[model samples]
Target: MAETRPVWVIYDDGSTGHMEIPEGDGDPALAKPGRLVTEAEYTARLEEIRAARAARHEAEETARLEAARADYDALIAGGFPEATARRLSGYQGTQAPAA
Candidate 1:
């Protein structure tokens, strides 16, 4: 029986995926335009990719919050009701009172 191992499939455009293949398969369809890597290296790279995605999500959330705050302030300044402003800004009215 042939032993199967995890191989990290790296694409030319810098994307990555994984597959399990038997040792010495070396199929051109799987090897061309993509490099195979050890499981340990694949795991480490996956962690780095996940961390980067998390950081980007956090940053986007922060920006969204900032924009919401600006909209809330503008609504308040325009004499709209506080509850209505909160709703428009995607808040649940449980947020701390605006300064």
Candidate 2:
């Protein structure tokens, strides 16, 4: 098996603060009793973090676009053309969004 190492972290302060260093490689005094993780575990954790971040960004963008579409519709209903409504409401789509 590949060499594994400690991932130093103390979560009592309600903040994310972790340092990755192999046991006995870095100063022992600086390390908080952390968990030992394999390289595979570390890489998997990184992928999970990346996926969660992407999902969050996608959800945020979907919400923003939905809001813009609503604004565009409201402007159109209030006597504006499709182009004018989209322009005024910052809607990026050229056609009405699918229901």
Candidate 3:
């Protein structure tokens, strides 16, 4: 039977988790009092967190762009200067589209 012992884990975000310690690392009882995690576990957790953060950032950016587009559309419809409209729309301060 494979021997397993509890191990302490401190996550990158200052959190903690515990897992079975590998055999031959002295002993679980003798292990240091610090965070511990398997390579696979750590990688999976980090990737999951990164993916979530990326998704949130993308959503926020999309919302911001949409708001900017709406404001630009309103300005263009209201007869604002073409250069000003394009600038507000994040364009290169070029001429606006012909009405």
Candidate 4:
């Protein structure tokens, strides 16, 4: 059986969590060093970190969608066909039949 030890994590945003260090001493690239904390504190901090990440991801996706819409509109205004515009804008909808 491999041995595991509890360790604290300090996230990039300054949030902290307690996690078990996997056997083989953990991957330095994947783990950040921090002072150890109680299990309860770790759980609470982990929730906060997850929530913050979700919010950030949502914001990024919204921005990307908005930009694609703008690009599609611009392509249409520039005389490109609707199907071509959508394709160039990275849209995944069914293409209209060629007239």
Instruction: Please provide TM-scores, in order, for all candidate models, with all chains considered together.
Output: 0.77, 0.65, 0.56, 0.63
lDDT (Cα, tens digit) per residue for candidate 1, span 10-99:
666556778777888774366447676667877787788899999999999888888888888888888889889999987553556566
In candidate 4, what are the lDDT values of residues 1-99, reduced to their tens digit?
Answer: 778877665666576755576767844343554555566777888888799999999999988877877777778778898889999987543544233
lDDT of 4 at 77: 78
Model 3 misplaced stretches (Cα beyond 4 Å): 1-35, 89-99
Between candidates 3 and 4, the lDDT winner: 4
Locate the minimum summed-lDDT window of 10 residues in model 1. 27-36
- Which regions of candidate 2 deviate over 4 angstroms? 1-33, 97-99
How many angstroms is residue 87 displaced in model 1 relative to the true structure, after the best TM-score fit? 1.1
Q: What RMSD, rounded to one decimal, does every model reach?
A: 2.7, 5.6, 7.5, 6.7
**What TM-score does candidate 2 get on C-alpha atoms?**
0.65
lDDT by candidate, in order shown = 0.76, 0.66, 0.66, 0.71
Tell me the tens digit of each residue's lDDT in model 3 across 10-60: 555644466675676663442345556676766676677788889999999
Candidate achieving higher TM-score, 2 or 4: 2
Each model's backbone clash number? 0, 0, 4, 0
Estimate the lDDT of model 4. 0.71
Candidate 2 pairs with clashing backbones: none
Best by TM-score: 1
